[model samples]
Target: MRTQVAIIGGGPSGLLLSQLLYTKGIDSVVLERRSRDYVLSRIRAGVLETGFVDLMKQAGVADRMEREGFVHDGTQIAFDGEMFRIDFKKLIGKTVMVYGQTEVTRDLYDARDAAGGTVLHECSAVNPRDLDTDAPYVTFLKDGQVHRLDCDFVAGCDGFHGPSRQAIPTDIRREYERTYPFGWLGILSETPPVDDELIYANSERGFALCSMRNDNLSRYYIQCDLSDTPDDWTDDAFWDELKRRIPDEAADKLVTGPSIEKSIAPLRSFVCEPMRWGRLFLAGDAAHIVPPTGAKGLNTAASDIHYLFEGFDRHYNDGDSDALDRYSEKALARIWKTQRFSWWMTTQLHRFPDQTEFDLKVQQAELAFLRDNEAAQKALAESYTGMPY
Candidate 1:
């Protein structure tokens, strides 16, 4: 079937893009390789930046968020037994919400269905081409048959491994990547959260971030070897490490219940230049990825959708191609900033097991500087809150 736009990937980016286009009286078809259930259940980096909250409110998906999402004014940075709060409001002129990406996905999925947008699941995109013809076409495989879909435009929200980005010739795109030596072993506990504001602690053992999905559900992460799996750390080992990482005063109050779930994720930063090529535009993880330390993944995806639709409006409705032409450079400006922040945060907090004594001391000193300097604190808060589009 023909459409105004064909969105690849059913993640937040593709779903949100379709919803936004529908608001503007445009029709788009979203193709997702995974089932709706899988997408709904997938856990992600939970913190939502300030700009993302604004977008959700604008899209009318914030009702549940308003009712359920936890709001925090700041996060605490603890090092050497001293805790200093980085008041997000005081630092960035805004505060963030502790909301999971799963909730956002569910909210947007329901909104898309309510708006009568099509989301094709369990359907793989074999190849997507930006036919230079007057009408661009995207061909995909669904139900064991190749379907050729003609469209006014295509959105490559499919992610880093998806086929959309490969449509651009390797010569035209420059790829940048950095892989961290450590990963986060996250856990969801049955007990209440240890504190209200999130705690990012730098300790002799390693790094630990104390956060929550809700008052009853706590989400915590500890630095681990990149090769470490959930099986490597027993429940007792996990609690012991957690207790050591948390400050002495906070340790007694921090309760460790049976871990409801556990998972390990390696840290990395990735970006591909020029987010758009001809009729195909890349958004979200399809275009770039940031380490989870900065908590910018979901927010970056939201910004990408906004910019993609803005470009779509200029190109399709206003008879102007300027926005469409500059979409890549425009989005990457924020993408790289977050990449730097995530990388910096990762390095400042996590103790690389492989690093020398001098390097470890340097990491400690950097954390100390962040705590003592107002300008540096403001920089962290600003990026954590998000940079404007």
Candidate 2:
């Protein structure tokens, strides 16, 4: 098989990139290690930065999103049993969309299918070969048979554990990672949200976030020990812990229901410098991962896709390789800033195992500064809504 680009993942990043490229008459093939059902089954972050929403629009998959996704003009921050709102629209003149990552993947998959794009699910042992050369190709196993796909370039949107990043020689690939001591124990429930907008709370026990997929489906999370597992907490126990971390007002109105999905996700900030390796370009989790505190996991991935698509457009249509040449630098520049924001948010809200009384006071002081100072709020709002592309 031959294609202009061989995408080594069928997640939102890979699917979005392929769909976006298709609009420009670029052809690509997406390979997924799991079945389509498995891919869509994973629940992820729901917040969408303005930049990601625009990318969805550009990819021609915004019909459902614009119709169903809620527009969040601001978010709430709670500390010391009190809550304050940060008006993103008022401070930064922009807003974020509350759309599930699952929905985003579904829309991209639908668009890809409608366009008759090639998306090979259950493709295993995927490997990108000769990435440093002009003739790059990908090989994978399917149905007990091995298939090779020749392409002009390879897109490593296969995520953190995928083969794309591993294909880069260790001598050339530089990886940086910081794993948090805690994890987020999240649950999805069919109940109205506790608040109109998302609430990020820092309490004496831990950090909690109240987010929603729609008006009816709520997603909530509370900080937990890394040793904890989903099976350790019952539905009632999870709700009780969450209520303890949020403000009394929200807790009073909080609706409890049977949890539809539950999981514990470890927080980490990881980045692989130089997202591009010759004809192979890494996008999304293959290049970097942020702690979910600032909701940059998918948003940063969209930014990478944005840059990679621009590079491809310039190379194929305008015959300019400048963007392609600087893909790693440009993508990394934006990614590091995002990592910083996510790290700062996580540090501010989460209670570390080693946190002292002084440390707690510092976190309180920082939150207080953000609550009282307009400049600080504006800065938080800018990062929360997203930095410019």
Candidate 3:
């Protein structure tokens, strides 16, 4: 089959791009490696940057999100036995939406279904070929048969482990990565959050975060050794560790419950240079990854899609090739800034195994400066809320 654009992944990034292009009357096809049920079952970051929220609305998929999502004007930061609030609204006159990534994907899927967009699931061996040429295509296996999709352009939205990134010839591709020595052990429970807004804590024990999905679905995380797994800690042990890492005020009010879900995620930052390789363009996890500290995982993906969609919209609708040509330059500019913020947040909040007495003191002093200085607080708020797209 032939299409204007062939998207390699049906996740939020690819679906959002397809939906946006559809609004412009452009035709595209999305191929997902897993079933829709499997995709929606995965849990991911919930914090939504302002730019991401706007993109959802532009795609006409924000009806459910805006109705069900919570607007967080600020977040709480705790250090040295105390917690303080960083008023994003007060500092930058902006706010972030607290809507789960799973919900966002669901909304996008529903929109795709309603629009009768082509989204093939459980397809294997999805490979984009002739990416450097004017005409590129993807080949995959499904139902014990091979199929080819020809397109004017291909979108490599298939994530880090997917085949999309490797399709770029090694001679032209550049990669940078950093894997943390620790991981985050998180649990989801049907209990009220310790506070109304999310709380980020840095204690002598480790870093912990208090977040919520809704009024009753609370999410909490604690820094752990990379070797540790979910089986190493019981629900009660997880709660106790979390309480110790946060402030006494939040810990005292924290409600304990049986964990509905549990998992451990290793922290890592990855980036691939030049998101665009000729007729093939990369978006979301295919192009970059940020540690969840700054909550930029999905938000960064949204920014990439924003840039990619702009390129597609301008080229297909306005007959402008300049925007499409500058896709990588434009996307990476914002991506690096996001990576720096995530790295900084991770360094500031988490305890490193190699941290010396001096290193601990430096972290404390940095947090103290952020708390005392209005200008520093403004910088954090601006970054945490998100930079302009």
Candidate 4:
């Protein structure tokens, strides 16, 4: 179908873009390869920056979230069995809300349905052509039938592995990547959290995080070998590893139950530029992906969409292409800053088994100094909660 924008991938980026454009009197359709249930029920990260909450509220989708989501003023960093809290209010005058990505997607899905918006699931996109050229269409396979969709512009929010990037001419794209030696073994448990605030712990074993989704559910992650898979660890093994990494004074407090979900996420920092080519634009994972250590993935995607909508507004309403032309450079500035922060946090917290004793001691000393130094603590707080964007 013809529309103002043809959005690929109905994840947070694509869906949110459609909603934002819809409110601006623009028409768009979202194409998703997964069912609504899969997107809604999937256990994803659960931290929302203050700006993110403001955007959602302005979009008129924060009613249920305001009631159901948990708000936290700060997070704790623990090492050597000692905990240091960074007060977000004192640091940035903002607090983050603990709300899972699943809930946000579900709310957006319901909003789209109620607004009579289209979200095509289980439809695989083959090749999306350029709008500047003669062929401006998206080819997809649906119901065992190949269909061609013509649209005014395309928004490639399909993620890092999706076909949207493959549609780009290789020579025009410059890709930058850095893969970490370790990955995260993430798990969701039915047990309540061991602590009220999220904890980032550094120990001899590795890095461990204790976070909660709600009163009844908890989420945890531990550093694992990059090549490790979900099947590599049993439930007991997982708990043992977690205990070794997570420092706890209360022996029986960090309790866990049957894991509802388990997955291995490889750590990587990547960026593909420029984010625009001809009439096609890219946002979210389609454009860049930062390591999850800083919890900037979803928030970055939302910021990308915000800037994109501004560009679209300038182009369509004011007949100004300046914002569209500068979108990539503008977005990438915030992107690389976050990428460095995430990488810094990752390196500081996670221990590499191959490192010498001297290296380990250096890292430990750095952490210890940062814990006591107000300047360093303020720096971490600024990066963790975001500076302005």
Candidate 5:
């Protein structure tokens, strides 16, 4: 089989790129290693950045999101028992939508199916070949047979553990990574959220987050040792820890219930430089990763797709190659900025294992400044809402 672009991932980033390309009459095929149901089963972040929302609109897939997603004008932050709000709308005229990543993926899949886009699921041993040459293709196993897909270019949106990143030769690839000393123990419950907006709390006990999928579903998290697992905590214990971290008032009103989903995710900040390797381009987790503290994971991936989509659109529609040539330089610029923000958020909210009294004091002062100073709040709002495209 032959296509203009052979995309090696059917995740949201790759699907979004394919859908966006389709808007301009570009042709592509998405290859996914897992079944559709498996992809949908993976729970992820629920916040959407303004830039990501714009891309969904451009792809003509924002109907359900607009109808069901809640618009959050700001988020609340807490330290000890005290809490303050940073108004993204009031400070910067911007707002975020509370929409789950799973929902976004589902919407994209529906749009792709309606458009008759090719998305091959359960594709095993998928590999991008001849990446350094102008003619690139992907090979994979299906139905006990080997298949090859020829294409003008390949998109490696297969994620961190996927073969796409390893395909980039070691000599040409450079990676930066920092694994946190702790992880986030999270639970999803069928209950009303503690507040209308999300709350990020830094307590003497640990770091915690209060978020929601809708009025009836609440998601909460608390910092835990890296070695801990979901089986280690019971439903009631998780609720108690979460309540201890947030403000007393909010916790008083917090509704508890049986956890439908529970998991522990270790925090990490990672980036692979030069997101491009000849005819093969990387996007999403294949190129970068950030701590979940600031909820930048999926949004950063969307930004990569934005740049990749623009490059493809220009190459196919406008006879322009400038954007394609500068894809890496441009994407990394924004990626690093996001990395810094996520790092800042993680450091300010979590207790480090080796942190001294001075470090704890500094963290407290940082939160205090963010709460008391409008300038600091404005800066937080700007980064939180997202910088420019």
Candidate 6:
């Protein structure tokens, strides 16, 4: 089989890229190693940056999101028993939407199916071959048979552990990574949120975040040991810890319930440089990863897709290869900025294992400045709502 672009992943990044290219009259095939149901069942961040929302609209999959997603104008930050709100709309005339990644994937899948796009699920041993040459192909096993897909270019959207990044020769690939000493113990409950907007709290005990999918489904998280497991805490215990980390007033009104889903995810900041290797290009987690504190995981991936799509569109429609040539430079410039923001937010909100009294005081002062100074709040709001794409 032959296509203009062979996408090696069925996640949001791959699906979004495929749908976008299809709208432009480009043909591509998406290969996934897992079932469609399995992909949609994984719970992820619901906060959507403005750029990502616009990309969804451009891909013609924003009907459901516009109808169901909630618009958040601002967010709350709590520390030392005091809470303050940073208004994104007031600061920058912009806002973010609360829409789950699962819903976004579902919408893209529906659009792809309606357009008769090719998406193969449960294909194993997918590998990219001849990435350094003009004629590249991808091979995989399906139904006990090996198949090859030839394409002009290959898109690696299979994520951090996927094969696409590894395809780049070690001699050419450069990686930067920083793993946090803690993890986030998160839970989903069928209850109303403690506040209308998301609350990021830093307390004496630890850090906690109050977020939600909708009015009836609340998602909460608290800092935990890197070695901690979901089995270490019960529903009631998780609730208690979350309450302690937020302001007393918000905790007083917090609703408690049984958790429907629970997990512990370690935090890390990672980036692989030079996203493009000859005819092969990497997008999303295949090329970079950011700590979830600033909610940049999927949004950064969307930014990569934006740059990649622009490169492809220019190359095919106008016979311009400049965008493709600068794809890595442009994408990496933005990825590093996002990494700094995520790292800063994580450091400010969480308690480091080696945190001293002076460090605690400095963190408190920083939060105080953010609350009292307009400049600081605006800076935070700008990064939170996302920088220009």
Using Cα atoms with residue i matched to residue i, what is each candidate's TM-score against the true structure?
0.96, 0.99, 0.99, 0.95, 0.99, 0.99
Clashes of 2: 0
> How much is 290 displaced in model 3, in angstroms?
0.9
Across 1-389, the per-residue lDDT of candidate 1 in tens digits comes to: 89989998999888878877877777899999989999988878778887788878767778999899988888988888768889889766788888888898899999998988889888876577754456788788889998888888889889888988888888888889888888899998878898898899888888998988888888889999987999999888998898899898767789888898899998888999888777888899988888888788878988888888888877778889898888888899878888888888888888876889899888888888888899988988888888888
- Candidate 3 structure quality by residue, lDDT tens digits, 1-389: 99999999989999999999999999999999999999999998999999999999999999998899999999999999998889999999999999999999999999999999999999999989998888888999999999999999999999998898899989999999999999999999999989999999999999999999999999999999999989999998999899899988999999999999999999999999978888988899998988899899899999989988998899989999898899899999999999999999999999999999999999999999999999999999999999998
lDDT score, candidate 5, position 326: 98
Worst 10 residues of 2 by lDDT: 273-282
Estimate the lDDT of model 6: 0.95
Which residue pairs of candidate 4 clash? none
lDDT tens digits, residues 278-368, model 5? 9989999999999998889999999999999999999989999899999999999999999999999999999888999999999999999
Model 1 worst lDDT window (10 residues) = 125-134
lDDT of 6 at 186: 95
Q: Between the candidate structures 1 and 5, which one is better when assessed by lDDT? A: 5
Query: Model 2, range 216-262, lDDT digits (tens) per residue?
Result: 89999999999999999999999999999999999999999999999
Q: Which stretches of candidate 5 lie over 4 Å from their true place?
A: none
- Candidate 1 clash pair list: 159-286
For candidate 6, the per-residue lDDT at 255 reads 96
Going through the candidates in order, what is the number of backbone clashes in each?
Answer: 1, 0, 0, 0, 0, 0
Report each candidate's C-alpha RMSD, comma-separated, in the order given.
1.5, 0.7, 0.7, 1.7, 0.6, 0.6
Per residue, candidate 4 scores C-alpha lDDT tens digits across 242-277 of 887766662258887889999999989999988888
- Candidate 1 regions with alpha-carbon error over 4 angstroms: 131-133
